[model samples]
Target: MSPSKQGKSQLIDSLYQKAKKLHWKQCEQCRVKKNLFKFVR
Candidate 1:
């Protein structure tokens, strides 16, 4: 992949990882919303 594309993917991966961590910290309704966001993405 091109450098820019690779960089974006890396950023997204990191964000996803962060989101996963946040998932556990979030309340039940927010967790469900995040799950739906993940599915839609």
Candidate 2:
């Protein structure tokens, strides 16, 4: 994978881990991911 792709996935992974640690609901996680996607774009 390209560097950009790898970095994005890693960012998502870290966000996911943080959400899990905080015990966020699935919907909340989805929303966060969506916001992150917008920011990334």
Candidate 3:
């Protein structure tokens, strides 16, 4: 909700999309969401 948190999440989301484009074989969308969220926390 905070500005900094929003920025960090946006960055992570972009990284996720970039990874997706690169064909990160290990990253499924559902699983990656949880893992990335946990990684941020």
- Model 1 TM-score, all chains together: 0.59
lDDT (CA) for every model shown? Answer: 0.91, 0.92, 0.86
lDDT of 1 by residue, 1-41 (tens): 89999999999999999998887667777878999999999
What is the Cα-based lDDT of residue 35 in candidate 1? Answer: 95
* TM-score between model 2 and native: 0.56
Residue 19, model 3, lDDT: 86
Give lDDT: candidate 2, residue 38: 100
Residue-wise C-alpha lDDT for candidate 2, range 1-41, written one tens digit per residue: 99999999999999999988777677788999999999999
Off by over 4 Å in 2: 24-41
Q: Candidate 1: misplaced stretches above 4 Å?
A: 27-41
lDDT score, residue 23, model 2? 74
Pick the winner on lDDT between candidates 2 and 3: 2
Provide the lDDT at 19 for model 2: 83
Which candidate do you rate higher for TM-score, 2 or 3? 2
